[model samples]
Target: MLSTLAMSVPADSNWINFDVPALIQNFWSATFDGLTFGAIYALVALGYTLVYGVLNLINFAHSEVFIVGCYGVFFTLSFLGFGPSVPNLDFWSIVLNLVLALVVAMVASALTAFVVERVAYKPLRKRNAPRLVFLITAIGVSFSIQYLIFLWRGPNPEVALTMFRPTPIFDVFGTIIDSQQLVIVLAAVVMMVFTDQFISRSRTGRGIRAVAQDPDTATLMGVNKERIIITTFIIGGLLAGAAALFYVMRIPSGVQYSGGFVLGVKAFAAAVLGGIGNVRGALLGGLLLGLIGNYGQILLGSSQWTDVVAFVVLVLVLLVRPEGILGTSLGRSKA
Candidate 1:
């Protein structure tokens, strides 16, 4: 074409070129960031997946539950006056603070879950309401939780500049893998392991499994459906709360409503991708989604369309496998 158009072309007519090296560098950066973000999403996704596994209902309010946990950490740290000042202490003291904050958040979120289950879901389940009814109730609970946070914080963002900061273990190349990421990853992993063990080994966990498999039969067999559902919510809530702590650490300043809505939506997508009612699927789905979103940005040098990419992937996956990566037609089953 160049030769053919030489008569019309001036000195040069060539193909467009871009900075390949820069693109490669950005891709790697995006990949790393995606992995970290994916880890966080996985933690949040666990809540959705776990509850869905047992109850067959998505806890829409789990997002706000996580935000509440974030607020719990923020307020606790605020009262301790640990902002912007590195408390000169031994490694053990720092570890203590971290553990305490994480525990508090987890406990608070678990309680929130319990309360929500009792007030919003249990009654309906007892009456044998349709799943759509539960869906509406979940949405109401989610918005109510957000409003309650707004009432407490009055639409202000929590910004702990230096306080409750995670100790950075080291740097990979130039990217800083701070203590916060480690905290989120470790806490989430521990909770996930505990949950897996509980469901697989413990008595109550067995009851929950029995309920999921066949609620009527399980009830006939002496399994208390209410107790199992409440337990599932508590576990899911605890994980969300822990995820909130690490999430806020990364984005220290954000509106209260932001976490529940945006992150919640993403985590739900992860849950569906991994197989909504499968715990392991949720983890894998969240990680995969996060990685794809982050790396896509690096490749394109923009995140303006990240949501589009996410939805597109969702659509493609659904088209290919409507039941998700690990989904089945056996109805609701234990993960």
Candidate 2:
């Protein structure tokens, strides 16, 4: 009876005894993976937040815009004879190819955004149509763009160009952090800084804010509301383009019609969680979401829990702070 009672007392009475090194490893891995994904999601979230700040309408097709960016870069690099490894390009040539791919993707994404606004939203805005019409239009536009990719690229996936050389960054604790991750992190930071400066300190930024605050008043003040709207889309699209490059760098797979949807939704969720329309909020929200998502999986010891963690965190944030952590109107009026 005494031996049975002692045995029933529990072999591990403390949670702290569950292997500290493994926990730390899991934490870092989760954090690194989350941040990498969050970086891309932050870019996409900026698009949703910015558009919402100005138009108050979600651009459902924005995900497809990101897919276009990935495809654009992939196709451009492939055309230049670069793949998992390029045999004979000098350093400068490699740099040039990368720059050109980035540029082309950005330009293509910007153009796509412009066309979407012109064909879909412009008519709706002009006719003073119901908001639901805009929503429907956005959904329709999203499907149309997705199907366009399907028709053009087909059911097959294309792989992007990746440098074959292994680097030192991956040597940390058996968790390989690719060189692409470094490049991605740096590029994302630079772009975010530029975006912040543009939005806060530039004349065009002021115009965007004015339009966002009140389009009618902005037009009355000669703010060129049309131009501001176009600029907004361009900015959003450019970020999406950048995100595409990072995404493909990490995954190096072909773009799919629905590939961008998950990212789009996650980014949109990040934006909302961080207080939509607030630039700083988007950043914070993205990082927080990423860290939570990655770490949650580690703690739970299952990859299947990743999506669940993200949604659970989002729901909790919504319930706790409906206004979000930063709680700012950004440029829009509060309801």
Candidate 3:
């Protein structure tokens, strides 16, 4: 069976290109692409970081929440009568469609996060369950949500309808920077800044921080732990939903049921790389990871090795700094 399976798998010929000069020549373009992808990873990582900061539990099913956002984009675009065959929209139409799709995706993802919290995590929390139980429950919820989507949407990848075809907005050192790339980076940065400010300055943000610091003390101080938890989940979901929209814009063919698995793992790695509970760490780690993976792929000569390269980077980083680049010591608030 192993022999047969090996024979059935096709070989990747483009796995090793050792053209250093060519790699150097395309460095700018690669960096642009990396930053764009890194921003998406950062957004997803924020979800992981935020939830972990508060609950100290890794919500493995957060990926499913992201997948829901992707589907939300798809259904919204379809409802708007946009598809592969449709012509690109006019300027105002593009803006309207994007706004609508973003709203829908955020709402869908937020709802999914709330439901997951209520159904999966809340019960365990109330019971004062062991950490192992929470981990197992998280894995179970992740699988259940993934397969449920598979049952509903089937195993096929959904193609996102392009509302606006990418047009080159500028050139950087002979590399053309397109509209989609600009949008992704700008949107991610804006969202990150907003989130950081909200957490650091807003009333609700203070509640979240207090809970992360000490749930018992926070409760005593009149912070509604349940409400704060729900808020954190909702904020994370909102970011994940926006990231999903950007992701499909970058890789339109990435809307399958299992799509979240690898991306989710990478995002988690990014969270850990940046200091899992640190908000800014997620952003920094994501961008760095993106650049590393892109450069590694170029150096290795094939996109097939991207995942391997990313994991290797993660392992190396962990070995050097187990707390992550900006991660604080355990039990300390870093967000």
In order of appearance, the predictions have TM-scores of: 0.86, 0.88, 0.93
- Tens digits of lDDT, candidate 3, 1-335: 44334434447863344546546877999899999999999999999999998999898988999989998988888889888764556789878988998999999999999999999999999999999998899889989999999999899998657767889999999999999999999999999989988888789988988888889999999999999999999999999999989987788778889988888888999999999888888899899889888887776656776788888999999999999999742235434
Q: Can you give the lDDT of residue 306 in candidate 2?
A: 75
For residues 45-65, write the lDDT of model 2, one tens digit per residue.
888878887888889888888
Report the lDDT tens digits of candidate 1 across residue range 1-335. 34334323334343222224445666555665676677778888988887887788888989887887887777766665556565666778666766677788888888998999899998998798999999999999999988877776777666644544465677776666666666666766677677667776789878877877788999999998877888888888888878877776677674365557899999999989888877677777887888888755544334665676777898899899998887831134444
TM-score attained by model 1: 0.86
Q: Worst 10-residue stretch by lDDT in candidate 1? A: 10-19
* Per-structure clash totals for the candidates: 0, 1, 1
**Best-first order by TM-score:** 3, 2, 1
- Better TM-score candidate (1, 2): 2
